[model samples]
Target: MSAHTTASGSTWAPSSRKPPLRARLLRASWRGLPAKRHDIGWEPGLVVPAADGSPLVTDHYFPRAEGDFPTLLVRSPYGRGLPWSPMYGVLFAEQGFHVVLQSCRGTGGSGGTFHLWRNESSDAQATVAWLREQPWFDGKLGTVGPSYLGYVQWALAREAPPELKAMAVQVGLHDPYALFYEDGALRLDNSLAVGAGMTYQHQGTGPFLRAMLRLRRRVRTAVGTRPLRDGYAPALGGGIPWLDEVLAHPDARDAYWQGADPGEAAARRTVPTSLVTGWHDALVDQAFVQYARLRAAGCETALLVGPWDHTSALQQGWPEVFTESLAWLRAHLCADPSGLRPTDVRIHVGGGQGTWRDLDAWPGQPAVTSWFPASGGYLTRQPPTDSAPLASFRYDPADPTPSVGGPLLSGAAGSRDNTALEAREDVLTFTGPPLSEPVEVVGPVSAHLRVHADTGYADVFTRLCDVDPQGRSVNVCDGLGRLRPQDGRTARLTVPMSATAHRFAAGHRIRWQISGGAHPRYAPHPGTDAARVDATEFTPVRLTLHADSALLLPQGAEDGQEVTAAP
Candidate 1:
């Protein structure tokens, strides 16, 4: 293990072994990383432009051995100093290629101030260019990551640099506005955390930090007296619509969003790519659409959807996920023994069914069965003969439903059903009868519903769960919809259900939950002034489930594709 520091300008030799920059960067990183039999580590490179025309920081850990290793470049807004890169970094590197992690222009030891994703594209492009110039680099490159880290890949891809051979983006911020706001409404929780966290991370983090602190205190005071039912947004009381600041633009073609379309031009090039997502992932649609678009454009792109939530990609069950991803990368950037052109797609079987299957493509030729909503908290095969007394719940923006783990949280903590989160009243639950035959639902999941709100604008959150005989509602997948729904055409939109391939056993039940909001999972849509009432006012919304509403199944798709089985 060798260590080299470019700090204030100094490069070192480790134990008399002189390695090239690429090997040095990765080896340095690997040496310091926590080691595990299943884990891999290495040093690579980071290219940062210095203010005084010197060097910024240029040592990284690309994931493969030196000598023409295909590269996977990751440029993160977070500190590369953090363990996240080393943890996921080395694994990808050892997957038969080079993996590189670099601190963004301003974060960590890299020189510069972080302006969110604004200036990241150039740094990423430069880093890729630098990587291509290395003796150990093979010139083939791809990018992968989630959230802010994922956002960087997309930002750089818009430029479509020559060396960005391909990418595998998860839960990325395609449209900052869509991610942050809902029709001018801000996601108070995300706003608080993001603004607060960044402020704390910055030097003096300045006014943003001070203001968020004060607002937090006010919010606590507001929610303190109200029953947990009054809701929690205004209670936090802060200024500047962080959501408004970012999500003001919802159109996909908007210059701001289109300029940095993470999907980039992978389709136009012969870039072989793969997309990773969870059934309950909020960004499922973004990645799904991108994967579809890339594939349609003749790029050798594959899609892999699982039942795990946001962070589950790193759990004990992630081996299969990584396996397929490695195979995909290996086929494209490394080596492939199978004459197969990297089996087109892969998905885990749904309904507690474990195993992976391959297919010619997504939404495969599958027999789609519809499960309609019944009157008495039941989701049945037959549409209700009588419109059961419409169940109603008070959706107070202040105390909306809290997220208890799911893809919507991007695998954030509350995603799984390990704890008893279903006990809350705000969460409306619907369960299906035990299965008579094993049913495997694969591919993307979607919720089709006719929604109505007393207010002009609204937010719809949905979750699909696997209920064991023990009555344990283990969340399987979830999706969110922010609606103004002013146009009748837009209200009937088909959103990608969190992608999953699960098999329901002979007796397990399927559950679907609909609620107004999921904190942190998404921001709340605080009813406008047009709606009356305040502390006592709760917006009552009635959502109608139509018999025609059905989950599309890619029937006949067997999980034998060149993909990995999900946990």
Candidate 2:
């Protein structure tokens, strides 16, 4: 485990078969140099028996020519054809690595029951053992995938498989609590969408499911209804019961979450990992938390953050992201880091700093700057001395503020034009004057608000926005905090907004939009101590924000002098 065998030492078997037509063309293009791309062929339905005696199905892809090669494995439930294998499995095989794309238990062509994370660890261990028995496997192996695919890598790494040399994980959500729920509020839209997709895939894409998916408006309407647990019964056809199980457990404290969470297995990890994520991705925050935990356990890790959402991280113009992954694999699996970008932290800064920055470490201890709310809808660096500077808004559960883009999987995800959202009377906005010079805020942001609600319970949502000279307000980061019954006393809510590295230009202003809820992204609070999403009782609650409330921003150096872009 101390060191991997060199690339030359590992490939002991010399290839005697002729290269495929595509490999020949690539060789011709390289003019006798090592070809980087080649044609690949796969053997379908390789039955690998799991520890439970269930057969796990996989498609193994390799270069057309016969030879010993390092293996790259991917275990996913999204099927093994088209997008999953054709896009990644074939790509790696063409690069001289044998790729194994397996469908999870009870999914695609695999066997056994399908319950998330229950069978992955054992199945993965058995599969790795099976690969070593194959004649074509060289001694090196690695894993790669994104989202759930990424989660599988982490799950298997927890088992500490000896052949598991390295991993390339992108947007992986190992914590089920955070994945399904946030701040004790259910992520309505995301939970429903994932369940619908799984049901469609698992139960066969029948006419009913296909028709329901096409009519998205009906889906949104159903999500808005009370008794959220049973709302999806019609669309899902009574299948994929996991959604209700998640809603039943309000937070991470429950034991149900332990099965899916990486748990103590993370400390056992010896595999070097490369993590890729986007600033706007729903799981970006969790991705960073996982990296920190792995690094604390003395594992080698690197991070790459882009300006993409969950979908764009894989589908959009993000080739450089995967290129970084390839380099990481080559370094650890093949012991060759040539032509590879150095292993370091890379981040994409938004808000007019349209470039990437490489750092020796994460932006060190951001200079915390505190900005307070002033009268007449304004934000100021100076605290309000006025004894009773207070603002009030009426929040009716029937008319909750709608979601407008930020860390969501729905179509309306990522930053969007928030001009209309900011204009709502129910949403309190405190704006600062145009900055005299540009300022960079590059770390976690939090807001401290002393709030009082007429009702026993309420939900507080805070957003950070950049107001351009043309009056367009775009969301940067936002978070939600639920307040319990104060019993006639004011409650102090410290809402920790998402982290970001954005710059406000000289002519732009900073704004904070405070509301009671962000529906669909988060279920609307029912104005009671019971945080259940099924309650439909609408109570109009008057909420007050004390002038002492302030936004804490982690600012960079004075002026933008210290902020530099990587070449």
Candidate 3:
């Protein structure tokens, strides 16, 4: 080990030993990852001052072999230990790239308070300036990481230097408001999960685990509180002021959210970018939005969507994620196009025994199919002859409808059996008969509902489910919309249920579920003209669905006849 001091007066000791056993084991575990090309060298706890003179803690890793290599910058708020070090620092270094893994302000012993997105852009630029002065920098740069780490990349990309080459964002988040609010309703559970993660994740593994456990155990009581704002602090071990701020603002148009989204960076920059996300990841829609903006800006971009959730994208899907990211970095940053794929978009189709599909672009021209809900709980190609209501359900805030498996931030996310959830009286299910042939839904999914609510203030939760032959209803995609009081008449609402690339197998039946709300997943509608977070009174709401309501799906040809709109 040899110690060297930087201009910032922070010393880092570089080791010339072989890669740690953990890093080697992790590499071996990911069979698809490229073979290691060099021994590893690393320096820990190097201080890089932020633009405002706040010290930012950083760690550097490089290949011991004699060769100039491109540098990959990874900034994270999730601590600089296990998983990150082995995953990014050691592994990428062994692959012949210098990796700089830094801790965000206020976390990992770095100075300055962590105000979420407040200081990221300036800190990122500061790190790059420090990189320019390093003796090992080779002028080529790439950025990679998941979630908040990905956010930092977008922050820097807005004003990136000429040396910045490629970026790979996996299951990343660009808009914090979108992550916490969907259409006007607060995402209670996701907000709480994010609160706990940001508050304790950087402390250490044990503390983070304990905090999560504490959150899990107390979530019920917390969500059940009279005033919704008071419920989460106990579960999180303390009050997270940022989370409180998020809860306070339910409208995305609020000025509080200004400058919070770095999505504009994608539209402005022409950087070659690669995005990875899962169909069930909580930020899957945000990833799609990023890709769309990048492509619209004429930037060279690629997309990889798997069949996993946010965390699973880094766990079970690590091999594929790592492989895709490595290929993108090598192709753009190292000028190695040999490893690049022929297509720009790759998606994992979900159903029985999932399969991968490559396409020139995402969701290339799928036929729009409409299915109408008829009386007797049937979803059919024919329009309803009756003008009467199709179904009705009552939602009680005190006993709000429970959320099932979906794009949640917790461990209980992704596709799970929705058998019990569909059985609730508050939930209405419209099922189509068994498919004569497999129906492939490959693009955006949405619901056009004409509903009448007894209370002006209510919510509509719509979900798409795949019902197997064995009578298992599994969630594929879902969306929630907050309803406001209108004159005592029917209201037409369009609920965007995100997107999916799922195959409803031959034996599977398609089901559309509608309910007043998916409690906890969304903060329950108080059924009164009052803000959900501040509402003290809980009121029950009766919502009736009209026969004219329809489920719109982007589908590919399956059988000879197409499922067209009813005349």
Candidate 4:
């Protein structure tokens, strides 16, 4: 069972007599995928069966590509085989898989418009239907992908593809806007970097992402390493349009984004799933939401949250993630297990330094709770005396607070923004004394406060930071609440910050900053000037962090399950 071979492997032969027209057309369908060439041999070409033209599909088939292997289906947005993702397709090919490198629909050779994650569910379902009929396919399929690609698997899983046996969704998105555009602000930088990387790959950069190799024997340095001159022009063209689309849409509710939301109904089920994540990952919260929701809904799932980011795992080699993944595939698809661990949640914990542990569920159990905040700087049980003046800070749209961390996508995406950028009068900061001891705050951190605007609409955003012993402020988490509380400012509201399991070292302090914008994800209030404006306008006015205003985090727990703190 270990050495698998495709039914059409060496047996595929050209016949002496001319083939029938329908047979020839099926073989040469201008529809499915084109034949591919790989070093091992002529790579099995595309495998799309005739379907409604709407089922645009692109894929690479390996005839016995994996030695005695089950199929490995990777629907990637990043052109497959790019060294950036560590030669994934080529490696799987070497592993004896009838590996299929799908270019999704609008991405590679497949024809269609790219709309992020929404339309992919139907596409994935149709793709499975085609692959199952392939002579080389074993009627079993498993999917793997990261980031946008990971989100694709999630959308597909919602409907539970009949042929889809399992999946490894790495850094996938549960909520598109939450992951990409937070609080209405544009995180232009990181999103651009991702776009650029994918662009470089799509144009077949093998020749150019590697033009430097041509210099080896000559011993002379290449005159230039520019992207265009190196053959990355096509990739650039491919990515630039997508990038432009991102910038043009400032509102999360834009029609363009609605079609890209993977987390909607498409990702609600508990398909047998394995998730990979990290404590430092800006995308960690989304994974947490997915894992918790899916598990609660009764899906057999496994989580491996290492202490890494978007790219670090591939470079450093977390064998556990990969080995366990293959084991999951084997158990579900190939029906094999060579000595695997079965615990559901595998976490690399921080706070008391770092280590690994496994639990049956996430936030696996109960946790401690503490509410810390104030009209001024304080983390006490007592509310600030009403006699004391309420805290106030100015928020100028021209000088809006730049973003930092916590489920971000732009340069100023997820992490805490430069305190220096925010300290410029637009942000209000309250700092407390260093912790008396190591304090583990591991759950959803939230803020409840009273806010006001000179006009009818306003938005309030909150960020939590860990001030080090040296007095530097590092962001931990943040949340946003947009309000049209003006003509009738609503009563005090509690905004929800994303959840996290973090530690405040004995010597570290905590800081809370409240501002008005994160942008592109959460629309910034454009100030109360425009009466007919939506909630995205900025509204300037005095803000009050009521005497009872505070930030609450669930505390120390054996398992990292989430807890909604009650006052």
lDDT for each candidate structure: 0.56, 0.76, 0.86, 0.57
On TM-score, the leading prediction is 3
As for candidate 3, its clashing pairs are none
lDDT per residue as tens, model 1, 1-567: 554332223333323223344433644543322233222444434455633222335445543122345677766655454334434465665555556776666555667655655666677766766665555555677777666666777667667777666666655555555444433434444444555444334233344456456656665443333332233345333332433334444355557554545444534554566677655555565677677677678877777666555556545335545555565666666566352334666566655436666667886656666666666678877755653334555576766667676544322543366335656665667788887876766655677665545554567777777787888777666667766646442255454455566776778888877777776445445554331112244455544444444444333454455335232
Q: TM-scores for all candidates?
A: 0.72, 0.89, 0.94, 0.75
Candidate 3 matches the true fold with a TM-score of 0.94
TM-score of 1: 0.72
Task: Tell me how far candidate 1 lies from the true structure as C-alpha RMSD in angstroms.
Answer: 7.2
Cα-based lDDT at residue 436, candidate 4: 89
Each candidate's root-mean-square deviation in Å?
Answer: 7.2, 5.1, 4.8, 10.2
lDDT of 3 by residue, 1-567 (tens): 666443345555556555456666766666556778887876778899988898899988887755478999999888888678888998788787999999999988889888879888888998999999887788899999999989999998988888999999989989999999887888888888889889998898899999999998999999999898888888999887778788888888889999999878645778899999999999999998998899889999999989889999998888788878998999998888887777788888789877777778876778989999987888999976765787898999999999988998888899989999888899999999999999999889999998989876789999999999999999999998766665454788899999998999998899999998887888888988778898899989889999989999999622222212110
Weakest ten-residue segment in model 2 by summed lDDT: 26-35
Which parts of model 3 are misplaced by more than 4 Å? 1-30, 486-489, 557-567
The local lDDT score (0 to 100) that residue 230 gets in candidate 4 is 27
Q: Residue 175 in model 4: shift from native, Å?
A: 3.5
Colliding residue pairs in candidate 2: 227-534
